[model samples]
Target chain A: METLLSPVVLFFLLGAMATLIRSDLAIPETIGKAMSLYLMAAIGLKGGVEVSQAGFTPDLVLAALAGLALSFLLPVPVFFLLRSIGRLDGTNAAAVAAHYGSVSVVTFVTGVEVLTGRGMAPAGYMVAVLALMETPAIISGLLLASRSGGQALQARGKLLHETLANGSVVLLVGSFLIGLIAGKPGFEPIAPVFEGAFRGILCLFLLDMGLIAARRLRETRSLTPVLMVLAIVFALMNGLIGVLVGAGLGLDAGSVAALGVLAGSASYIAVPAAMRLALPQADPGLYLGMSLAVTFPFNILIGIPIYAAVAEMVAR
Target chain B: MTSRVANKTRLDILVDRPLLSVVTDILHDTRVTGHTVLPALEGEGAHGPWYEDQISGSQRKVMVICVAEPDTADRVLTLLQPLLDSHGIVVMTSQVGVVRGSKFA
Candidate 1:
């Protein structure tokens, strides 16, 4: 309940409600995009700075590999469920699967805020894990999609280019590197933009995200009841898997919670760009609706707190 | 005084921005000489109303316009048919008059 009332989450709820009520409120496109970029850079810089402070550790390596494993493997079960239960075709199933396997950055930021509020901040190096987890799911999704046996698989070269050059990936990894190099003294000059204003920008960004997701919910036609149920189920299962992996790797309680949130959240930004290029036939309404509308809200409202509780229990 | 008018096909495609490259590739492969792409501000469709002002770029649309010779337009359409079928895109073509058909060619 406290999590839901946080200013950022409340702003998100307000945006969703405004859209639901047909209010005329809206943010400009460029500003919203800029806000997203700001959030990414801030998180990356913070992570790099934290890693610098903590020094290199074996645990970071294990956490990273765990992230990679989760990213690559999570989609297999999702693809099968979508095919066997949801009765979706191979292409659509794969597209939606990719979304589940990848992480949502905004959700990650939200988890950090929520946990920090509770006096349990995750390790900064987990930001690197977040970046690492973005692309493997795309590869896993494409490989699964190829089994359907068509020209869709022929774009392997192009898909590789798109995945590597994706704006989110480039910006995130680049910013992290800059943070790593600059360390504390280097980050000092830009702290105001990247640090002081992070929460305010996050509120703005989430508000816009709320509007987008709610509007999409209104327009979504392809998310059938079975798929809807699966969205929630998949999130819970994936989040639990993430928690186990994090614990197995000996992560701290906060880090474990962060991992769970990363695993539980679905990609709405990076994966969709790749899917549109590689799986054009897949219905946007199905994947976008499931990820942005169903899974995203579920994670924010319920999954975060549940994961945090689980992490606390396991750590004790 | 009269102005010269030559027949040309105008192709208009409203598609997601990220896939604009794929659409443009099809046009280039079909031998189109020139095209224009405009950012879509907002609109309604099977997925309801959407605007460019969202945090995620998935829902944003771009409008690509191409004026080309009839045969070139036909070829472009042929290549784009499968993509159009698969993606949530709107493609329309109409008979248009151009002052310089050679430019389009």
Candidate 2:
């Protein structure tokens, strides 16, 4: 309940409500994009600073391995389930499955804020874990597509370059490096922008996300009832898998919850772009509608707290 | 009173920004002299309404315009045929009059 009432979450709900009511409230596209960039950079830098303070640990390596494993494997079941239960084709099932296996940066950032407020702040190196988890699913999804035998495996060879060199990945990994290089004393100068103003800016970003997600819900015709139901199902199931892995690895409760958050969150940004290029025949409406409209809102609104509770249960 | 003009085929391809390269590659492969790519602000199609937004990196559309000889335009269309439905590449062709036919050809 407290998580739902947080200012950031509240702003998201407000944006969604404003859209649903057809209110004239709007954020300019450029500004919304800028806010997203800011949030990414801020999150990356903070994570880096925290890592620098803690120094490298064996646990970090364990978490990275866990993240990579989840990213590579989570899509297999999702691919089959989407084919059978959701009644989707091989191409689309692969596309949507790739998304469920990947991570959403915004959702993780939101998780950090909520978890910190609850005094369960995840370890800083989890940022690296978040970054590592972003792209492996693309490869996994492509492999699944290959099995379908329908030119669903066509890789124009641009996917690897694009996925790795994507703007979000570049900014995140780059900023994290910079943060690591410039430890606490070096970060003092910019703390005002990255730390002091973090929550306020997050509120702005979530407001824009709310509008986008809600509008996507309204405008997209690709979402069938089964796809919609499966979106939530994927979040819960994937999220629990993450929680279990994190707890089994003996990570802190906050870190375990963060893992769950990352696992549960779907990629509307990076993976969607890759899907558009790699799986051109796949419907954007189905993938985007499922990730952006259904899963995103559910995670921010309710899944965060649930994951935290589960982490506490299992990790303790 | 009017300047002399030559008949040409104008191809305007509307495709998502990411796939713009694929479309351009087809034009290049077809030997179209040159083309102009314009950022599309907003429009609606069989899928739905789309507009420019930097975040998702997918919805933004670009209009690639190439005026060329009929043969060149035909080759471009032929190359783009497979992608038209699969990639949502919208190619519009019309007979047009160009003042500098040699420039486009």
Candidate 3:
């Protein structure tokens, strides 16, 4: 209830409403990109600063391992589901599966905001986990696609570039390193920009997201009722699996929920680019429609709160 | 002014951001004198409406323009032919006059 009413989520709803009504509300493309970059850097720096203060811990290591494992393996089941239940072919199924397996930075950022507001802030090291979880799913998805000979975008040089050297990964990792090096004293000066203005910026970004998502849903011709149901199901099932894994690993309530959020979220940014490049034969309308239009909004409106509640229950 | 300009082939490509490199490499491989890449804002196609989505970049597109000799343009076309249907790449070639056709060659 709190999250749904919050200005961040409300702005998102407003954006969607504006688009749905054809009110011509739009955020410029460059501005939207800039906001996303800023959010990534802020998340990274804050995580790094917190980690620097807390230093290394066993839980952090465990979280990282679990995150990597989940990212690498989650796509397998998703591929099968997409193939059988979703009635998609090998290449398309593999493409969509990669998206479900990967984490959404925006979704994680929103989850952290809600969790923090609820007074259950996840450990800072989870940012590292967030970064780690971004790319390995691409490897899994590609392997699945290649079995069906969807290897158009399989040049290792290009794959490495897309995975490691993409703008988001670089900004997140670089900002984290800067924060780790600077520590508390170094962070004090930039606190106003990064810490003070964080929520407002997030609200603006989510507004753009809402606009993009709603507009996409309206424009897409590829999504069906069954596929839409599968999108929600993937989020819930994967989220539950994430919570279970996090709890088994002895993560805190916040971290466990954060894991659920990450697990539940689908990658619209990084994975789509990779899939488009690697699986050009795959339908962008299907993958993009599922991830950006359906799953993204669902996760924002319902999935986050559900994961938070589950984390609370499991933690107790 | 018309007579002052020499005859050349103008090649324009509407390409997704991811494959911009592949197209440009074809340009390089075909040895087009030079090409300019521009961001495409919003457009509709057989797929649907698309805009310059920088975040996901799947919907984003670029317009690559090159003025080249006819032979060079033909070579570029042949190289990119395989990707046209599969990649949704659209290439347009038109005959145009340039002030420096020598430069294009």
Candidate 4:
């Protein structure tokens, strides 16, 4: 209930409702994009500062390795399930699976905000975890596509390039490195721009996102019950895995919830673009609608609280 | 003072990177011998302005232009319509005065 009433949630709701009502409300495209970049940089710098304070630890490396493994491995099952149950073709399955294997930075950022609101914070090194998880899922999705047939092999070069050079991966990892090199003094100079302005920018971005989501939902009428069930189940299972991993790493309830949110979220920005390049035959409507319209809203509105409760139980 | 000349066909297509091959394959199937591709920086769509930094590294839009005979354009557009139905594509056909009608045809 408290989570539902948070300023972030309320703002998101306000934006969504306003957009749905066809209000003349919008954020300029460039401003929305700049906000996204600023948010990424701010989080990366904060994570770096925290990492600086904590120093190098074995747990950090282990967590990163585990995250990579999960990213690479999770998509295989998801691909098969989408193919068999959802009746999606090879391209669509691969595209959707890649999304499941990847993480959403926005969700991770929201998790951090939630934790902060509750007076609990995770180690800044988790930003590294977020960055590490971005690319492996793409590689996994590509591998799944290749295994489907020989025709996909011809596009291997393009696939590899897209996966490696994807935007989210570049910004997240690049900003993290910048934070690490700059440390505290460096972060302080830019804090006013990146940190202070983040919340206001995020509100604007969320407004744009709300409009995008509503439009997608309006266009998609064929997202059947079976797929909806699958989306919900996968989201729940994904969150559970994150909770377990966070607990094993000795994270508290709030931190565990944050990790869960990170794991459960799917990429609309990065993976969809890569899929368009790597899996042209794939139905964008199916995967894009699923990720952006279905999974994203579920995680933001409902999954966060459920994860938090689960984390509390486990911690207790 | 304008004289009627043989009309040549022009085709323009805009697509994402993944579908580039599929589009090329359509061209190949239609026996298109030559074409030019230009990169799109960014633009708005049903989803909004697809930022280059959002998805794949290339984050580019490609515009494929081909000038061919009327018969070839008709065949190519028929094949292309479905592939591009869910995706973004623009096809335009305009009459061009061919100086060397035999070679173009």
Top candidate when judged by DockQ against the true structure:
3
In candidate 1, position B92 carries an lDDT of 97
* CAPRI quality band, candidate 2: medium
Chain A TM per candidate, in order of listing: 0.98, 0.98, 0.98, 0.93
TM-score ranking from best candidate downward? 3, 2, 1, 4
**Tens-place lDDT digits, model 4, residues A1-316:** 7877876766777777776788878665566677777788788878887787778787678667767887787788888998899987776778788998888777778777776776666667889988888878887887787777613633567667867886667887888888788888888888888788877776666666666666566666547778877777777888888877877777666667777777787877777777776666666667777777778777878887787778877853
Task: Give the DockQ of candidate 3.
Answer: 0.85
Model 1 alpha-carbon drift over 4 Å, by segment: A148-151, B1-3, B46-50
Which candidate would rank higher by lDDT, 3 or 4?
A: 3
Provide the overall lDDT of each model, using Cα atoms, as 2-decimal numbers: 0.88, 0.90, 0.90, 0.74
lDDT of 1 by residue, B1-105 (tens): 126888899999999886788888888888899999998988888667767734557667999999999998999888888777667779999999988778997
Measured against the true structure, the TM-scores of the candidates, in listed sequence, are 0.95, 0.97, 0.98, 0.82
Candidate 4 residue-wise lDDT, B45-100, digit = tens: 66455533232222357789887798988999999887565556667777776655
Say which prediction, candidate 2 or candidate 3, comes out ahead on DockQ: 3
lDDT of 1 by residue, A1-316 (tens): 9998999899999989999999999887788888999999999999998888888888789889999999999999999999999999898899999999999999999999999998889999899999999999999998898886534563667778989998898888988888988899999999998999999999998899888888888778888889999999988989988987898778999999999999999999999878878887787778989999999988988999998989888853
Better of 1 and 3 by lDDT: 3
Quick one: best TM-score, which candidate? 3
Off by over 4 Å in 2: none
